[model samples]
Target chain A: MDKLQRNERIGILMKLLTDSPGKIFTLGNFTEIIGSAKSTISEDIDIIQDILDKFDLGMIVSIPGASGGIKFIPSISSEKADFITRNLCEELSQKERILPGGFVYMLDIIYNPVKIENIARIFTRQFYKKDVDYVITVETKGIPLAFATARFLNVPLIIVRHYNEATDGASVNINYVSGSKKKLQTMVLSLKSLKRNSKLLFIDDFMKGGGTAKGIMELAKEFECEVSGIGVLIKTAEPDRKLVDNYFSILTLDTVDEENGIINIRSSR
Target chain B: MDKLQRNERIGILMKLLTDSPGKIFTLGNFTEIIGSAKSTISEDIDIIQDILDKFDLGMIVSIPGASGGIKFIPSISSEKADFITRNLCEELSQKERILPGGFVYMLDIIYNPVKIENIARIFTRQFYKKDVDYVITVETKGIPLAFATARFLNVPLIIVRHYNEATDGASVNINYVSGSKKKLQTMVLSLKSLKRNSKLLFIDDFMKGGGTAKGIMELAKEFECEVSGIGVLIKTAEPDRKLVDNYFSILTLDTVDEENGIINIRSSR
Candidate 1:
């Protein structure tokens, strides 16, 4: 058999690890695929390990048991996280995203990758530090951030929709007093989505009257799920009937001056 | 330097080539990481080259000279694409996620790694078959699929939202008739999120009214960005207006039998 180069060897290993997120590979698989000795593969792993460490892309964890081969750890450094957060704030705090009367357009905050990646990483870092089982958010604006957080943590994301439908048999519906619009509205979530006593991290785009957030919280309670953390891309900071605690934000909006063509964005924290 | 495993070395090399996306790496860099002689590393590359071909993930193109190391095709196979489509169908068809209103709760379909990873692979394989600078979707439900797809394609994901706000400027706004309610609603997206003429793959959770989808299509046109492809998890198959041409759906629901609690789903299609 022809010999293999070091660079070529590392490339193959990364693919195997990424393709199977949680699966541990065995040395035998490599031998069969590459037709190389186990010793040669071990040396290749060391080379791949160093390169991964240098780039801060991910980690190659090796298990000693019969079932263990290697797994890649998805990680984000503080520097990268900060870079993403700053970009997100700068980009989302623009004039075009502002709504007709006063609301800010927030979909941009969750969409941009350069920004979302950071939010996802930071949220993941914070979530890992806490005891969160999964990330949860209410649709249709909160999905991006929730998805990112879930991806980073390697956990599932559950969403609560606006109305209760006959399709999902048993759902917990919550009616919250909309402090802003001052009306009662419904929020529904599948009972199976939220596990009992499971830790959850909540995320959304904006917080105004906090009614929706509050409603989602109530939905969590209905499932007996624990709210571990709350993170938002922006907040109105209305200071009344606050929906969440233990939250973080990329930016805060103090006020929106439509007539003056001025919008205030809170300092990044 | 210590010797390394051949397969491990190949993994490291592939990452380096992928780090720069299209850029090729030099043999020197590969040699340095593996700490193996150039000849040994070159031999390892040969084995990896074939493995890549076998897995149908991509190809390792070797470049000769001082500046040349190796390059990855960053391509996917048709088999992977079909696998993804099948997985998406299965995920969306799960019995537990069926909503009472004849809607399939899609939160789980996009959030599950096993499902998201497959969906991502398919997007990269079939739609973004050429160049996709970004994965685009509307807030707030489509975010999960978009994020995963973008992550796999190594591109950014952009979210379009309703209501133009100040935070997202340099954006294009368009009005469209919504499918769910048959009301005209405005959608906004950041111009800066997408580049001119760049290819974008649009994804969404469900297509009932296609109003939001139409609005998104208009927004893409306004931005002068190319709509490379369109995809959805569920297509309701509305009678009159068709919002997207190129798309895929896991399940197609024909009608909702509200009285008998029966839903006619297009499982085979």
Candidate 2:
């Protein structure tokens, strides 16, 4: 049997670790794939680890048990996070982003995979320690962010739909009052989407009066799950009184000038 | 400046290429970051390319001329894709997935990032040559798959919403008949989502009568954009006739036994 070159082993190792950010691959598995000794694989990982650390990309965590291997934890440095946040703030503050009724047109950012990937990294850094079973979000807009966050956390994403449908399979629907609009709304979730006694982290693109967040909490109750935390990309300053507490927001929408078509925003650093 | 070791250079290069799957990075940029010469970076890429080829992973394409350097194209081998598709089919065939009215409950697959990533890879590989400006999908279930495909294609994802909201700016709304339910449904997209003469690929989770796909075509016409392709994860076989043609589907739902909770399915391959 031929031995794998150092460059080849490192290249494949890098691909495996990066493809699934939070998944753990055993050293034995790497050795088998590369047809190398465990010691050689460990040395290769050291080099890979050094490169990741120097570039502030992420880290390779080694579990120290018989069944343990290596896991890649995706991360961005504080400097990079700050730069991304400020850039997003500037983008969101553009004059044209101010839609009618003080709503901001920021779907461009929400669905931009590159931008959302970075934002999800930041959100994961905040809640990675929570041992969450699933990442939850209310449909339609927040799906991407929540999906990205769940990808980083290596958890399943549970979506709460606004309307009940026969396709959802025995959903639990609840009526809640919208905090901002003060109108009755229905939120639905399939009973099979979540498991009982699970921990959930709720993420959304925008938060106003936290009415939806509050509704999510109520829905989780129906499934016997706990809402551990809430994260929003942009939280409005109006209706300063929020329906839910204990949430993290990256940016705050201070005000929107409808007549002048201007938006006032600030980062939550 | 000290030259970066081969292992370190390969590690970081792999990370850079894999992190943003389809994004291009210049040789000059790599040299500047690693403090290495162009010749050395080229050699490193050769080694990385060889490794990728050996493992049946994605490949690195070197573009010529002044504007190109290198781009990472993500892919999965035919064997792997078939395995994933079969696994997904088995999962979907479970009796619990059959809801009332013969609808299959597939929200779980839509929200599972790991699965969606693989599925997106399949879709992107199909339409990678189309030079699409945007990957479009109707909101809610299809967002994750669209976002994943857009990420791989290195394009923006445009979500068509069911209800127009103030946050969408000026949206173009059109009502279409539900091909299956025979009901009138409204679908919307922000007028600003696409540019004139742009190309788009429409993707969705399930296709019944292809009414939504047809609506997407009409909406794109409003923006003066062209629908280049359509991809759906699952298509119902009962709709002997579809509203759109030249579409790709991974799985076909032949029939559903709602009483026995059984689903008849087949692989498109």
Candidate 3:
């Protein structure tokens, strides 16, 4: 490959760093790829960091040591996060989202790639400090949100299904009661999913009674793992006390009045 | 925002365009955001496009005439795709991945964020020309892959579940036979999931008889939609004739010899 100009180097560096958040890259690595000196690459990184900071995109953290290197951390300013959450609350509170059973139909919002990415950025900011090894979630509605969170955190995702599949081989299953419904439900995870003593972050679309979060904690015990962090898109207001105490939620749902076509929701912040 | 420099403008433009693939952005929009002249923004875009071409990251497409603007399309070089597929084949054929019942454990690979991004890039290259409205998949293993593909294509993701939830409101349920197992299975999707007369792309982790793909086609018909493209990460060699005639696959699984601990797999290309 030929030598790259400063602008080209900045573009390439920005793309590479942002694409693989949390992955370390030594100065030598970039020097070899771009055919530049270590000093020049270091200067390029500073410029990229400045751009990232100015745009509120993310930050570049430089580690100091023999094996130390720089990595990208996905984050957003508090003001930006608040703005996004407010917009989400407005979109979700629309009367048309109410269904027959007082449920706010949120498939469009949760399954949307762009919106999920924004939401995941907030979750990543909340949980990145935990040094989570994996992002786990129950199947169905929470998969996309959890997947996006995992991507932002640069961790492997583990999905616990309601049932087992032949392709998963030997698995561990646990039963837990739903927090609000008090109904028994089985959570199945492949035995090979997690390493022993690993830390997990549980992400979900909704949390009514925190039953699912507690269930994940219990399931984590079976693998000799721990649920260090929990984040959800929405939580109910009536459940003043939840099964688990420590959690981050983007929005709070006060009520959904099917009769009046009213949805009372607000940002958690 | 202050007046940006050439390198900073390039970095910002690259990040914004790549982050939201397929979303149109007018030069006036960039001028307002970067506080630059329209002509300056146009020149910056040309430089960015040149850098993208040199790096094989992707291309910045220009759209002319009224109501037209430039958009980013996620793609990778054919050589890079081939290299990634070959590496995957090597890793998957390792004897350790072979499990009981001749099943290969692939949760780690499918759930991995970086690997899924690379694989999704290949899928985007394959199906982006279809102008797909949504990327659809069944629950469980395929969610992450489908989500990544939807992100790259800048479309909403629709997950068809095996059971119904009240949060989804009214749904349409259909029963189909599993391709390899020949057992009847049900797929449920919310009635409001897809728009009428929309084009859909089906993506999955694995395919044996392509029954799931075929079922997606059936489900599309009920919604007055059409399945415009199908892409899978891996397909079996035994089923020379699949239920679907047209589809794209990245790898082919020939056989897994349980006794000898030998697995045969190769890139589809």
Docking class of 1: acceptable
The residue pairs found clashing in candidate 3 are none
Tell me, what's the RMSD of every candidate?
6.1, 1.6, 1.0
**Which of the two, 1 or 3, has more DockQ?**
3
Q: Which fraction of the native contacts appears in each prediction?
A: 0.60, 0.86, 0.81
lDDT digits (tens) for residues A1-269 of candidate 1: 55555555567677776555335577788888777889988887776667667656666667687766766555557776666666666665676656666766655455554456556667665556574778888776667667766765667888777676554457787888775777887788866666799888888877767777677677778888877788777767566446555567766777777777677776447
Candidate 1 lDDT by residue in tens digits, B71-171: 65545676666665665555555555556556666655666655676666555555544567778887666677777777656676787777654656556
Query: Which run of 10 residues does model 1 chain A get worst, by summed lDDT?
Result: A106-115
Tens-digit per-residue lDDT, A216-245, candidate 3: 999999999999999999999987999999
TM per candidate comes to 0.71, 0.97, 0.99
Question: Looking at candidate 1, what is the lDDT of residue A154?
Answer: 61
DockQ of each: 0.37, 0.81, 0.84
Question: All candidates' lDDT scores?
Answer: 0.67, 0.88, 0.92
Cα lDDT tens digits, model 2, B101-197, are 7788888888899999989988877888787999999977888999999999899999998898887888899999878878998988888878899
**lDDT winner, 1 or 2:** 2
